[model samples]
Target: MNENMNTSTIRGPLDHEIRDQIISAATEHFSHYGYEKTTVSDLAKAIGFSKAYIYKFFESKQAIGAVICTNRLAMIMEIVDAAIAGAPTASEKLRCLFRSISEAGSDLFFHDRKLYDIAAVASRDQWPSAVAHQVRIRAIIQQILLDGRASGEFERKTPLDEATKAIFLIILPYVNPAQLQYNLDTAPEAAVHLPALILRSLAP
Candidate 1:
């Protein structure tokens, strides 16, 4: 049985159940087949729905694709929030979120071929939502830096915005397009070095 199917009916959250199935199937298809290769019909089949049912739920493939973006963003935010809760300092929180983002990449949506295809599409086409998500992440990092300054953990002279975004700028080129691309083994070292590197900007 496909994990993406629902047998129960007659409910509110259960209606949401079908939507979840659709998302799961679309994720697999996109990750496995890529944007151009994955079809609405395949998505419908994966969700155990008829073509008409898919149309009833989503106006088009693009609509479902947009939902994919929404789901991916939500997953990333959940990780960030959870990481921040466990972190003691703003700098640590920032590191936590970066690590969280990297970790979330390994989840079904990001690491899977169907899911990575969305990222590939965004990278290739320069999708606005993808760009927006990146901006928000950079902003979040900057906010952490500013807070660290308030606590005297970061240098007063550090340009938080630039330094925050620069972290990604530094890592972007060497990153592998496939998988989560975290130095999971080296992440603890990075967690330490990353904060220090940002704090360096504040040094006199």
Candidate 2:
């Protein structure tokens, strides 16, 4: 599905109540049955609606999956933001960000394996939700680097954009759903030690 396609162009009027009902039902269905196994027809049957009715709100099965994926990523960012807000310094905030991401990914993997599978597919398919989530994460990292440099806590010699990209790459294994499981065994140690190493390199 073309993620950029406007909903209004293809779908019916999005009545908030109806949309919520559909999304709520879909979430339960996806959580229990897994994304790939569930079809739009299955969702409609579960919600007591016709297949055509479901299509009025979502263009395709992937479209519905996109909404669920977006919500999950948003929740992760909220947790990350709260972690950053609680830390007193930019360096500490950066550390919190790293740790929070690793923790969040682990939580999803162990507690919500079905949803994690959806995220893995989204990441692998380059879905818009996954792409947008990565962009938001990088922006947060960039802001932290900017703050650190302003406070003389981090080196000013490195270009801000370069530094942000480097840090984002370092954290990608934990952040990318497709790559997360492979590194889970080492994530706990890396989450602690990697930030320390990055902080040392950034120190003024």
Candidate 3:
């Protein structure tokens, strides 16, 4: 049987299951065929639905791809959340999140190049959801900084928002998959020490 072929009903109400199948099919197709090459018709055929029906669920092929990228970002945030959970201090949580995000990006670069490629494209295209996810991530950093301030772990000579932006600017290479790879390739030693350097600079 074809992997994407759904035995369950795809007709009528278009429940969560069908919607998921559509996204899943779209993800597989995007990964294998690239976003520009994958069409709504292609996804509909994979999901055993009409092209019109596919649009009923997603606004466009790009929307589907953007959603997939957003989902991946959510997964990365989960890793960051896990790393922050047991950490003893805000500084430690920030450090843990940074290292975990780098590790996750490295793992994706090494093991799931296609997913990484999709994310890179999403970032390049500046899809709405992808852009929103980036904003959300920056907020997460801001909150971490706020926690650090509360604990007196980090000196905030600047405003929290300003500090957050500055930190994110410095650590962009570690958080961005494309830049992460470039840094790791061109300056392996700097790439390894970048997180710690940022933490120290932020310290009181």
The CA-based lDDT of model 2 is what? 0.88
Query: Per-candidate RMSD vs. true structure?
Result: 7.2, 1.7, 6.3
Cα lDDT for residue 37, candidate 1: 76
The prediction achieving the highest lDDT against the true structure is 2
Would you list the clashing residue pairs of candidate 1? Answer: 30-114, 31-113, 31-114, 31-115, 32-114, 155-202
lDDT values for all models: 0.61, 0.88, 0.71
Number of the top candidate by TM-score? 2
Q: Could you tell me how far off, in angstroms, the CA of residue 53 lies in candidate 3 after the best superposition?
A: 2.7
Q: Model 1: per-residue lDDT, tens digit, 26-108?
A: 77677667766767887777767898787756666765665676567667667777888889988678667656665565453
Question: TM-scores, in order shown?
Answer: 0.67, 0.94, 0.80
Please give the lDDT score at residue 53 for candidate 2: 87
* Candidate 3 off by > 4 Å: 1-15, 184-192
**Regions of candidate 2 where Cα sits further than 4 Å from its true position:** 1-10
TM-score winner between candidates 1 and 3: 3
lDDT by residue for model 3 over 1-204, one digit each (tens)?
A: 001212231334446676788888877776776766666787788778999877666666665666677788788878878888879888777777667777777777677667777677766666555567668768878988888888888887978888889877876776666567676554445444665787888878
Model 2 Cα lDDT, one tens digit per residue, 1-204: 445423543366666678778888988888889998988889899999999988878888888788888888888888999999999999999999999999998898898888888888899888878998899999999999989989989999998899999999999999999999899999999999999999999999
Q: How many residue pairs clash in each candidate at the backbone level? A: 6, 0, 0
Better of 2 and 3 by lDDT: 2
